[model samples]
Target: MRRPVLATLIAAAAASALLAGCGAPAAGDAASAAGTEPGSATTPAVAGEITVLAAASLTEAFTTLGRQFEAAHPGASITFSFGPSSGLATQITEGAPVDVFASASTATMDDVVAAGAAAAPAVFADNVMEIAVPASNPAGVTALADLARPEVKVALCQPAVPCGAGAASVLAAAGLTVTPVTLEADVKATLTKVVLGEVDAGVVYATDVLAAGDTVTGIEIPADVNAATSYPIASLAASKNPHLAKAFVDYVLSGDGASVLTAAGFRRP
Candidate 1:
């Protein structure tokens, strides 16, 4: 009778051990199922795509910075729409799904801020107007006054654009008048006319001339007569990726970004 009781106890112990072994997951497996490593917590990756509406003058620098941003955050990416600041501002107010806006001037940015499309923007850079002529300079243009010659064909941005406004200011300061052969939608368009020799010269930002490299020659306006514009950046209020948008903005304001901008011939604020 004692041996029979002992056998039954042994059988019960074996059954209990089997159930315990089969019922519960191992500690490592439980941790993994909970989305963590057994001994460490994981950080959420900075991952998402964002669209940035930037001034045409920022094309080169911003493109470089965007690449850097993506490389720094493995799962993140950026798409850029480069255009006149005024047009971009209008797009933002019209509910375009842009994550960030980088304006060539404060006035254009103010329009967005006033519309509640964006908040207070930080000025990141300053740029002055320059006269970009074709490499050949067919009109023999040398000074700002040369643009005033009635025979010279000139290209200017539309009045609504920041580059246009800056050019206007510089002309006004110098007490000179110029009639452009064509009014372009943006600085790049104006520069293109000069590059293609469609116009004798184009009034554009100094940075635009720098970007053109060997394709164009830049004539500097006198400091006393030159006009400058401030570049401001903001994250749009309706951004689908707000965190990533803000990160890009902050990155532009960082030292790393400053170096790139400086290399691109932009003046820091």
Candidate 2:
């Protein structure tokens, strides 16, 4: 009787131990399942697609920066819509789905801000007006005054665009009044007219001339009469991914972005 009772007690003790072991996983297994130990530092995942509305003048530089930004933030992507800043601002006000807004002029950005579509913007860069002519130099445009020649078929951006405003300011300062053969919607279009030889010359941003490379020749504008346009960037208030939108804006203001902008002939703000 004593031996039977002792065997029963031993079996009960073994069963209890087995049950306790089954209640919890091994330490290594627990750590592996969690993918991190307690108190460990982990980076938050940044993954999403953002749409950026940028000025036509930023086409080259922003495209390069967008690629670099995607490379840095794995699983993140950027889509760009490039056009006149005024047009973009209008779109944003009308409920366009844009994550970021980068304008070539503060006035254009101000309109977005006034519409409550964007927050207070930060100036990212500045650009000055330059005269772009066909490589053939059809009108023999060598100076700013050459654009004022009656025979020169000059293409200028529409008055609503930043490039046009800058051109107007510069012309006003130089005390020159000459009608343009064509008024383009944006700087890129103005540059295109010169590239296609449709116009003798076009007033465009300095960066636009650099972006054209050998396609067009750039004539420097004298500092005394030249006008600079400020580029401002902001995260739209209606952004679906607000955090990512702000991050992209920060990236543009970062040192790496500055290097890219400088390489494309933009002046740092």
Question: Could you tell me the TM-score of candidate 2?
Answer: 0.85
Give the lowest summed-lDDT range of ten residues in model 1.
38-47
Model 2: per-residue lDDT, tens digit, 114-142? 99888779999999999999999977999
25-81 in candidate 1: lDDT tens per residue? 788887777656785545234579999999999999999999999999888999999
Q: Candidate 2, which segments miss by more than 4 Å at Cα?
A: 1-44
lDDT score at residue 254, model 2, on the 0-100 scale: 98
Q: Could you tell me which residue pairs clash in candidate 2? A: none
The RMSD of every model to the true structure, in order and in angstroms, is: 5.6, 5.3
| lDDT agreement with native, every candidate | 0.92, 0.92
Give per-model TM-scores.
0.84, 0.85
